[model samples]
Structures are given as C-alpha cells and as structure tokens.
Target: MTSAAPVATESGVPLRKPRIGLLGIMQALYDHMIPGITERQSGYAREIADRLADVADWTVGRPVKDRTDAEEVMREFVNADLDGVMVVLLTYGPAMRVARLFNENRLPVLLANIQPEPQVTAAWDMADMTYNQGIHGAQDTANAMVRADRSFEVITDDWRAPEFAERVDRWARSARAITAWKSLKVGIFGYAMNDMGDIRVDENALLRALGPEISFVAPGDLYRGSLEVPGAEVDALIAWENARFEVDPDLTAAEREDHARMQLAIEKILVERGYRAYSTHFDAIGEDGRFRRLPLAAASSLMAKGYGYGAEGDALAAAMVYAGHQLIGEGHFTEMYAMDFPSDSILMSHMGEGNWRVARDDEPVRLIHRELGIGRLEAPPTFLFRYRPGPATLACLVSLGGERFRLVVAEGEVLDAAPLPQLEMPYGQFRPDSGVRACMDGWLAAGGPHHQVLNVGRHAEDWRVFCRSSGIEFVQV
Candidate 1:
C-alpha cells in the first residue's frame, strides 16, 4: 500500500503532482485532402505532451481524427483514474466528436488553444492553414463546453511559453487537490467545543459541501492503544524528542515517558485507521479516567509528520489545515489572539499545538510541561516555538448554510521577531498585506472564523484555484 504522506519540499510545502490524460484532436477530411497534415499535427501533439509530462503524469493518446478515434481515447481516460483531461485541438475537428464526451464525463477539462505555428504571415497558404487552424476548433469546443455547463479552462498561447506551462501546472495541482478533498477522512476524537457557533458544522452538510467523511473515535480506543504501546517505543520517542528539542530540565523522565506513550498511541490509531486529520477536546480527555493527561504533544508531532490537527474539537479547522498542508506544505491551526496597533500585526497562537517543523531555524523548539487549568490532569509535555518569518497565507473554511461553504483567505507576512517566552505555546505575529485593521474588517465582513490554517507561503492564488475547482466561495482580504 502507498503511504498517504504528500510530496513536500525541504521547507515542507506540498507539491501535489496530478495525473491527466492528453488527447489531440484533428479533422479526418483534412488528413485525406493534405497527405502530411495529420503526421505534422501528431508531431506537434507529441512535443506538447513531452513538455507537459514533467508537470503531470500524462497518458498521451494518438491524434483523434474521427468519432471512432475520439471514442477510443475517451474510453481509455474513463477507465483510468485521472484527475483531469487535457484536450489539444491540432486542427479544426467537429465539436460533436468530443463535446458530448466532456459533457458526460466528470473529470475537469483543460483546452489547449495552441497551433503548430506561432504566427500567420503573408507567406501563409492552404497547407499551413490545414495545420495551423486549431484556434477555431478550440473556440468551437469551448463554446460547446460552456453551453453544456462543463467546468473547463482555455489556455490560448504558444505551448513553449513559461506562462502556458505554469497555468497547466496550476490547473493540475488544483485538480489533484479536488480529488484529495473528495476522499478525505477525518477522525473526530471528541465533539465540537460547546457554544462555539463558528466552529460547529452539520456533518451531512459538510460532507456534501467539502467531501470529508467524519468518523467518531471512542475514548476507550485511545485508552487501550496507549496501554498497549510498548516500553521500547515510548523510550525511542523520548530519545528522539530529547535529541531534536531543547528539553526543559523541569520536566521529569516519567512525564516525558507518559507524553511519548500518548503520542505513540495517537500515531498508531490514526495510521491504522487511515485518518488524514483529527481534532481533540480537552474536556473529553480525562472524563472517564482513560487518560492521565491531555495528549497535547501528539498534535505537534503528528502535524510535523503531515497530519492535520485542530484544538478544542474544531474539525472544520482540522480539515482546512490538512488541505492547506497538502496544497501548500506548512499548515498550522491558529487563532488571532491579540492585535498590536504599533506594529500593525496580529498575534497568532494556539493552545498547545503547532506544526513544529515550521519553527524558525534560528532557535530550537523547546519541550516543556504545562498544566491544564480546566481538567483534573497532570501537566502535559508540549513544544513551544515561533513560526519562521516569511510570506504567509491565512485561510478559513466556514459553512454558509446547508450544502454551502466559503473559504476566506488573507495574504500576509510573518514578522521577524523574538520569541515570547512568557507565552508558553506556538505563536507568531502576522501583518496583513492591507495592514491589520483593514484586513480584519474585511475578514469579519466575509464571515471569517477565529480558527484558521496559517501556511508559510504566498499561496493565495493556489487557494483561489482550489476554491474555483471545488465549488467554494472564495473571499480574499
């Protein structure tokens, strides 16, 4: 079985390479009238396919000249698990040859409005027309797709241009993200935090809108799993943590072992059950004496391993964080705790968890034990660090109503600042592109929720493409 982990960069940004089908279209009548036209067009199709192979896992088909050829190519694409289809109009083929196939199929379509020649001069003749008239065919197919209400994008440019390849890459990534969203599975360890209206969602409505299947995990399962964790596993985890983090002297060896046990148990259950993301509620941790302390450290460690986490049972936030990680690479669940007018920044922090992998390289992540003020539990070991300073994007997914959702996004910068030792949690300061005040006002107007996924990159355009492909309302601040 393939591991569920995404392909990421050194800094942990996910690059979702998509699988697509590339089919070239041409008119059979022209092939008979001009003996070499089909061969020349096929060569262009081959070159374009080769150029795009690095961006996607492309299954290239021979040039389609008639209805029979179109049907055969369509069958191949339908049989395979493809994210989308890339249709190249080599010359003017009838729209009916492939328009109905696209209308009936569910995969997203990208129309390549390109020709063999980049320019048409006084030297242009009938022979050149037979090979370089694909633009009209692209327009014909695009019109039919629009009439049929199909989701398609047209790229009209020289195939060798950088922008053309970039657009194709963007569409491929967006299509892959859409596929990932449709099959996402999130384990809900506890119910949503009470009275948190913004974080609560209707499961059925959420499934219909975003396609994440929710599964409730009983507390007894975690309890059993924790007890079953071997002593060697716990010891290895503690040693790993000690080697990677600045361990606090105040934390006892027993406390470290207990934290490692909880982390191991969480990892085992999530991996065994194939969960992409999860949420935890402090109130549910020790309710039945199943846990000695809250498993606060697991959240950070799992996130570093590419699992999404949301605190206080915010499953919507969890799903968004997972998607952000898969779409961009570094995703941390956070809330805007305070506004600093002097610096025009918002203090972003979470309760006790973050993707520790995104911590600034200048400082080591500190492992410290902290008490839960609300629960009758022992102090839990968690990581404390500041996010790396860089360009960032804040994204929140919220329900608008039944079967409807919206994605609110803001482009910002994580300011370069010293870590606040007083705040014993993962934290960072973010300054929005439009300044803090204007951004906050716009965010509120768009119904942006408190819990959000903070990622280290300028990925607002990526989010926009994802939202467009997934049928979600996108509001940018």
Candidate 2:
C-alpha cells in the first residue's frame, strides 16, 4: 500500500532546514535569552519559547559568558551532529568576533528575541536603555549571524502577531515535516504496463533526493486481498456509481450491494498494506502469470476515483498516484492517455481515491472495459470540469537512459486545449485534460525520455527548496 501521510516536499510543503542547534545568548540578563523586568515581557518571551518548541525539538545551550569568546558556541553550531541553529541574543559582544565564529561553523541560523535591559548607572536613562537592549539583541544576533557568512532568517515579533507567528511556526514545522516524510515508506505494486515509456527512476537518487522508500508489492497479495471484502459497506460504490453516471435513475439494489463488495475489498487492501498510493497491472493475458478475476472496470473505476490504480502499473504512474495523495491529499490512478482537442475545460480523474481533485464544474468519470493482456481498458469517463491553466508541474517515476529517475521535475500548464475526441464509453464519460498530447509531444521533444507523473499546483519562488528536499530534479520544461 503506497501511503502519502506527509505531503511531498516539492508540492506545497517546503523542506526542513535539516537539523539545527539553538543558542540563546542571555548571560547579560540573568541567563535568559529574553530578559524581562516586567511580567508582560516575560510572558512574551515564553510565547517565543513556545514557538521554538513548535518548530523543532532542538538542543538549547548557553552562549559565550565572555563577550569576547563565542568560539564554544560556534563550535557547537558547526559540530557535525547539528544541521543549523537559532540564537536568542540579549547581549551585543564584539559582533565581528561572533560573526567570524559562526562563519567557521557554517550552520544556518535564526535570530530570535524579546526586549532586554541595558547597563545603567544613570537612573534617568536606565529603563529606556534596557528596553532598547532587547531590541538590539535581536538585531545584533541577526547582523552577526549574517556577517559571519551563514544563511539565516529572522523572527523578532512577539505573540502580538498571531498570524505571522504561525508562519514562523510553519518554518520549524517544515523541518520536522521533511524529516518525517524522508523516512517514510510507499508501496509499488505490479510492473509497468507496456507503452508507457520508462520514467527511469533511480531509487538511490530518490533517497538522495526525496527521502521516500519504495516497497515492492505482489500481484498475488492484491488479488488475494480482494476476496476478503465483507458483505456490508455499500455506501461507497453506490455513491460512486450514482454520482459517476448522471442518468436519471439510480443503480439497482443488487448492483449497489455487489459494487460495495469491491469497494470494501479495495479499502481493506489499502488498510492492511499501510499503502498511501500504488500501481499494478491487472492484465489478463498471463504475461507474468497474473490472472484477472473480475472485470477491472469495477476495480479500475474504484481506484481512479481517489483510489490509486495505474494502468501498466508503471512507476511514473505510481509517482503520479503518490503526488495526488501528497499534494492533493488523495491518490489518482490511471494509464497514460493521448489528448488532442480544443475545449475550454477538461477533467483529470479516475474512479479511485485521488479522483476527488477533478474540477467539480466539469464531468464525472465512468468505467468501461477492454482486453487485459493488451493493456488499457478504455471507456469514456467524466471528472469534474475543464483543465486548470497557468503554471503547473509534471513529474514521473520512470526507468530509462540506463537509469530509473523518479520525476525530477518539469513546470508546465494546461494549454488552450488537448487534441482528442469525446470518448465512446456507453455511459456519458469524457477525458479530463485535452492538452496531454501536446504535453507528451513537448516532453519528448525536450528529451524528457518517457513516462512521468503529472500534477497541477500554484508555483512559488522557493520551488527549488522544495525539489532539493524532495530529492527529485527541479528541471525546467
């Protein structure tokens, strides 16, 4: 079972800043990063502390007691065990010296702080100077860290800014999120079906790049699980068929009861396997001795609608399934399709788990049949509405050019329209996107090699950060 618990890094989730060491330089004010003479300020400091906790499970340590000696802090930051560090400054020792130490350690840093007091023998100006000290501490930390030649970000605002605070929280959360998904596992079922060019995915590259582990799934396991469906659980299939086929009448009791079994079996397989997404070839030709029990129309329909069933069981398609689960928070499964038509809209859907992403304004998908051994059982299917234009990203988990590369990355969009005709499945169903033909053509022309996973999402400036963390290539299309 391919499971997509954590969203893929490249898709809207940013990669974590790896591991970091947090250092709060508060020796100037009672050994606290945020020094406070009043309770309100102290409470603000606590909020900042809570934010750190929200961001990462970090190691907090003392800074240089001697304003002139920050070598120890720098050493700890640069120590191989840590990835980066956050510093809460309450003092402004020699900025240059502190800066040099950080440069040597070369770890990422974040400047965090609240107000601090200043040295005041003159009562007339003491309180004001002290308040200024806290503000300066945060700034000095930022300046020193940046001057030291390390990449650093800053967050000085206190709890008053709840929304912005959450943004900072997301940064720390991003770190944990990347790590959590990096060590995650996804299952891949069956082998790639024919005609879907090699996506050339390199597992090592993926680990080096994305951090997801691909587990192999057997056809027998999937098939065996299908037999375990219970007698109850008819809601899913009935709802699907009814919503899918826009006919005035609904499905009969017998059809609903029967389809329910298949849906139940499908869900059970996912549950038992701990899979977030998967692709498998249910070809009946016995090419690999795998037999076809029930008409895949039912299973395929179930899988495409939000379920993850890729035709040919190709890796690239599996990656697509993975993307749907991660980015869309669901999985979409299907075979490579050709498109050449001019329509303002189209659908991107299947009859399974990931199908929910289809434009609700378009059409719904319906399942049809074909010979299993030959590959690709075709029938017109409706998915929500037309294609979403503008910036989009396409990926693929493929093997070719002597290597298997999982997606890397390509940016594109739904063009004017795809070039294809209305499908001919008995029930009124239509293909999703019309620009696929052009997409494939452009990909082949650009030396994309073969099969790839496709998805659409809003782009951001930090996209590269997303790629680096995910372990896939962020190639320009």
Candidate 3:
C-alpha cells in the first residue's frame, strides 16, 4: 500500500520554544498590609519574568491579588494556548483559586517558590519580611495543588541561584517538547512488516498515548505522484546528488532519475500533509506488489534533509527518530545489526537509510547500486557510508502489549571501525558503556525492539525527563 502525504530546517534538532504564561500571586491581607511590600513583590515578579524570557516566550501577568485578577490572567493563558505555566508566589497567595485554574488547563507547570534574597540579615526590615512572605506561601500553594489533585514540578530557591535557573530552563525545554508532540504527525505508507511481532505498533494506541496524528498512505498514490513530477525537478535533484554524493560509476542515469522522483514524491507528501516522520516497507513498493524499486537513496537523502525515515514500515522507529532529532538536532534510524564480541562492540545499521548529515563530512556518502534481495526488479542506488565517530545514545519505545509501553535507553560511544565490504548498507560500530555482552543482555531484558533511534550525543537524561513528562515507563539499560 502507498499513499502520500515532514522537523525544523537545519542539520541539528531545532528547539520548539515554549510560550509560558508567568503569573505572580499574593493574598489580600488588609490588616497586615505593609507599605512598598506590594511594589517590591511586583519588581521581583518582573525579574523572574525577565529571567524566564531568556529560555521561553514569557508573558508576565499583573500580580494577581484575588480570584477576579487570577481569573482574568488565566483566561489569557487559555486563549494563548500556552504550553505550560509558571506561578511565582510574590506573597502568601490564595492557593485555592490558583490551583483551580491550573487543574483546568491540565498543562505542565513550574511552581517557583523563589525568594529575592538568598538570606535574611539583622538589617532586614518589615519591607524585607513582606517581600519574603512568599517563603511559607510556597507551602500554601503546594497544599492547594495537592488538594486540587494537580501535579507540578517545584523549584524552591533564590532566583539568583544557579541551580534554580538550570532547573527552570530544563522545565521549559520539556514543556516545549510536549507542545511539539501534541501537533506531531507521522505517515505510515505501508503495513508493518509481517511476522516481526516485536516491531509491530498499534497506531491508535500510539496516537492516544503519545499525542501524534497517524496517517496511513497507499503506495499507488505515491508512485503516481512520482510519475507526475516535472522532468526539470528530477534533473535538479540529479544535479544536486552529483554535487553532494560520490557518484558510483555503476549507478545509471535512469536509476538516479527514478530514485530522485521517489525522493520528490515523498517530499511532496510530507510538505502537503505536514508529516514530520514517515516509514516505508519494501514489500508494499515491490514490482509485483512484493517489492518495488528500492527507495534506499531517497530515504537516505530525506534523512539528511532533517526528515525522520524508517524502513519496513517502522512507525515507532520513525517517530522516535523524529523525537530524538527534535530533542537534540540529529537522529539516525538504526537497528541492532550484529554484535562483534571480538571488539567488545556492536554494529548498527539499516538498509542504506542512514542520515548522511551524521556521516564523516570529509568522506561524502558514496552512491552505489545494489540488489537488496527483496524483489526481482533491477537493483537500486543507495548511499553507502558510516556514521561519524562520537559519543551517542540509543533510544527505543517498545509496546509491551495492550496499552502499556516502555522506553529503552543506553549510552555508548560510536567507535571508529572499518566498514564491512560485504554489507552494502551504511554501518557504524558502537561500544556500549556496559560492554557488548552486557548491553545485549540489557536490551533483551528490556525487551528492546530491533529498530531504535540513534543520536550523536548522550540524551538519556533528556529522554528520562520526556518519559516522565509524557507518563511513559522508562527502562534505562
């Protein structure tokens, strides 16, 4: 089956900046109203808002003193569709009112219980006492949220503290990612590979649990679109390929044109449908409906252009790739190709669908034609190269049957090794922190799928935060 339909533009994963609603709160204590306490609190609120502006698109709401004021600002946040909210306690505020609004939105929140001064000194006056009244107000807010049955991450420290800023920044990043997830769209152009139960995914479950829209495409639609692409577009793609790749003498012009058309067709689908990630299976594109022309080159090219691409209709792998890229900047589709005990490493690769952007820049990806043994059709061209050597991590989201799912993660080093001449696909050698055998055991223990997302840096921490934010089980092996 095939029907047609796309991350940020760059060689790295682009950050989805969060639009945060910033609110400062205080209770109306008319009896204990201290002069300049409100003004000082307002100034502190401005400072917090300015700090947040460094990491997020923040809108500072007027310091709310009562339910009427809180409701007005809450309405603005709702209308703006904020990814998350940050509530700063200027003084002991009415937690019931604030908690109610937060619970209704059901978005992630940072309950910042920050004091302007790191410490109180002998010279401290009533104004200082009034300004720092937020000290115990944090407990009030926490109690209110607990009563309202709402969850929030708390930072109870001075804004000037390095740790406070770091924690807040991390929360903002996590919120921005959640925003991206809600609007994500993934395209599955064919059915899952047969009999590979481990890699099979339930589209509905994925959509409900992870908040991405899934689109099923028919193969014929893509093929027809490819044929309709203008010859000029194909010619431009060929020219670009010749300039970018180490063209193989064995790759015929006709083969290159066909591959280019496939790339263009896929690109059109992604652009039109707003898909950020996609998957394809050879069996659905074959000549006799068993396999069609190999789309290895097209897949590789798309991956280099910042689109997540997975082979054999691996929607999970593609989505993970997209997520990893969004979180870091670069992600490659890979599998546990083979274990090389002799070198205490594991080899990772797919059928010529590696991201060329992750390959060694000095050694451009080589274009080559290969008979991938999938169909009886003519061999297709593929980009042949290995990923660049660097510290990396592998991440996989596996369905543990029913609606349960778990994330499997492992940190590793991309070792420098000679590519196997016999293997036509792009390959990389990796040495896990736990060694090859132990890593394999861990993978098996976690029930890790063969297909996963590989990225260029240690992203286990980020993945852990994401899993927590999304309520997914995490098994870091």
Candidate 4:
C-alpha cells in the first residue's frame, strides 16, 4: 500500500493565536454624576484594545458599569472562549460589582492598572481624574481577589508606555501556552525504563496538574507499522536525510533503508493519531529483536521538525518539551551528564537523540552508526553534533506528588565547543548564570528531574508567568 505524506517536512509547531477578552469597568454612579463619563471612559478601553491588536486575538466588550452590565459583558467573554480576560478599570468601580464574576469564572485574569494619562500635570483637570484615575479601582479589585483566593497578574503603567505593551504581550503569550497545555496529548510506546525512579510520574496526578492526555502504544504495533512502510517512502526519506546531514560512508544501503522505514512509520503514527509528543523505551524496543536497530534517529528527526520526544519512555519530559516548543519555537531534549569544575560548565548530552536544529551553524550534523548492547540489536544510525553556542534556558517539569508539579528552570549559556567525535552523541557544555555548584544545589533542592528541555534564550520570566497562569510552581535557578 502507498504510504501517507511525510510529517517530518513540517518546519515548526503551528500555534493558534491567543484569544483575549477585554472589558472595561466603571461605577454605575458615574453615569448619573458625570453625564458622559461612561462613554468617554469606554473610548479609553477601545484605545488600549487597538494598541494590543497585534499582540492577541482580542474580543472587546462594552464598558461594565453595574451588576447588570458586568453580568452581560462577562457572559460575552465566556461565550468567546477566551484564553484569558483583561479587566480594565475605566474609572473608580466598586470591587464587589465585578470581583465575584472574576472569582467564579476562574479564567486567567490580567488586572490592567493602566491609565489614560502618563502623569498628572498643569493640564490635568477633572476630566483626567474621571478617565485616568483607575489605579485605585484596580487596587480595590486586587484586594478583593486576594481575599477570595483567586490568582491574577496586575500590570501597572501608562497604557501608552512601550513597557506596558511588552508586558501585555508577555501575558498574552503565557495565556496561549496555558491553552496549549490544556489540549496536549502525549503518546508512549512501551513502558518507562526499568527502575528509573526520577522520570517516574503518577499519570492521574500528571493529568490533573498539567492537563495532558497520555496514550500508551504497544511495541508490537510499532514493529508492524515499520514493516508496512512503503519502500518508495523509505527511499525518499533516505534521500532527504542524505541531502540535509552528513551521512557516514560506512553506513550500508540496507542500514539506511531500515532506519528510514522505521522513521517514516513513527512519523505516520504520530501524525495520524494527532500525538503532539511521544516517548519510547529503548530496552522494550530492543526486546524480542522486533526492531533490529533502535529508532534514535527517528526521535532526533522528529524533534528537529517540532515534535516532542523523550528517550526511555519519559512522558513528562515529552510533554514538557512540547510546552517549551509552544512557548519558544524550539526545544531540545537533554540531560546533564558531567560537570567540568575548572571551566564551570556542565556537559549535557543524551543517548544519540536530540534536536539537530539546535546544532552550531559552523558544524554539519553527522548521521553515524551506534551500537546498542541491548537485546539482539545492531548498531543504529543516529545524529552527532555540537549544540549552538548562545544564551539558553534549561527547564524541567517535576511532579511533587498528587496534583502538584513544579517547573524548574535555569538561565545559562552554551559555551563554544567542538563536537566530541569520541562520544558519538549530540552534546553541549552549558554554563549557568549562577555558578555550576550553586545551580546544581538549587536544581536539586527544587526537585528537578534529570530529563530536561533546553531552549534558546532566557525564558525564566515567561515560564514564571506560565506557571502562575496554570497553577504550577516555578523555581528558577
């Protein structure tokens, strides 16, 4: 049978734009006391929404003046299925009028403490007080939210400030990440590595805390699928790989074809089943000699194409890497293997699996053969390269038992390094902003797992915001 189109050709994860609902709040008494106060303040809300137009998918609601107006507007926001709500206090509104609605709805809230005027000056008059004096209202609402045990973020600044827009954009991105997390589905082939305690997680707890659906696949199914992959597709994949990466001359034609068939089969399963992330146990795949070679290259290629993959059936790491991809566009699956005390750098690598897209520009990725001493298996073709030297973030999601997960993150730099031809795996040397000793101490103290996702750039604050929105604990070292 003819095979389906290759899923590996897709370049990056397609993220849906974050949907945000903007609502303005004001006291009902203002309508009678100041004839045009509500209408004028509503104009300020529209201006702020317009400024944030490019940042998110905005659904602007009419200014809410009393319980009646608040209920109606809140209904609109709910109907819009927003990722979050930006509550703009247009004027001095009573907290009781809208605080309960926020508490009950439980949507991630951004209390916009922005004012129309940047500063009070000689030109400031009663009109400025009527329109720009919304900070006190924000304070009142925040106090009520705290008493009611609700989570929120308060952004205080003049709406016109560049920083204000940047902060809003960050919040919108975090909201989008949270939305993606809620809809994530991860697949696992075979069980986790035998007696691997650190990577073990309680699936029920994981689902409750992180909102990912886990689907387990039998190893036999993968073996059968690999056999069914069309020879034409396998040849095409081998040609594509040869063009992109440096194929070792020692790799035989049969070896390349077998690896290509396995890779195609894995990609087909993931794409057809709508799995955003996946994991496989090496020992299990090697068991019974169903797979002559482990599919390490398959994992590497999938990761390069923006599909999350964790070696040794690490489902949590798989999901976390996917989340990192959604937030930062690229993420690499890795673990700290050794520490260089003299250089203050930690050696990071995995068992012949990593996103080759993160390789240094100066070096070409090499697809080489690897030997697995496990269960009647031969050497498989996998990638070997040096990670890009730049600022990066190392992050992991660890379960703190039932319904509790903490995101441990560290901002670091991947030091300039040459590929270790002797190691025969994708590797990098990372120096944390905090010294190696301190970073290690802090990471261990925060219950960090060995398997972590690395992404380019410093994203601790983005993760902090994401954790707050999703109710996960954030620990940055």
Better of 1 and 2 by TM-score: 1
Per-model TM-score on C-alpha atoms: 0.91, 0.56, 0.89, 0.93
TM-score of 2: 0.56
Q: What is the C-alpha lDDT of each candidate?
A: 0.82, 0.44, 0.77, 0.84
**In order, what is each prediction's RMSD in angstroms?**
3.2, 9.0, 3.4, 2.2
User: Which 10 successive residues of model 4 have the least lDDT summed?
Assistant: 4-13
Off by over 4 Å in 4: 1-5, 14-16, 67-75, 374-376
| Most accurate candidate by TM-score | 4
Give model 4's TM-score versus the native structure.
0.93
Cα misplacement distance, residue 205 of candidate 4 (Å): 2.0
- Candidate 4 lDDT over residue span 1-477, tens digit each: 666637356354566677999988888777776798877887878888888887888888988878788889888887877888898989888888876786786567888898887878998777678777788999888998888877687798878888888888888888776766777788888888988888888887777766787888888878888889988788778878878889899888878878888888887888888888999888888874667888889889888777888888898899888888877767799999999998899999998889988889988999997776754588889899999999999999988888888999999999996556589889999999998999999999999999999998888888888888777889998
lDDT per residue, candidate 3, 148-227, as tens digits? Answer: 76556777777887777777777777776666677788887866678987777777887776776677788876777788
- Model 1, residue 172: distance off in Å is 1.6
Arranged by lDDT with the best first, the candidates are 4, 1, 3, 2
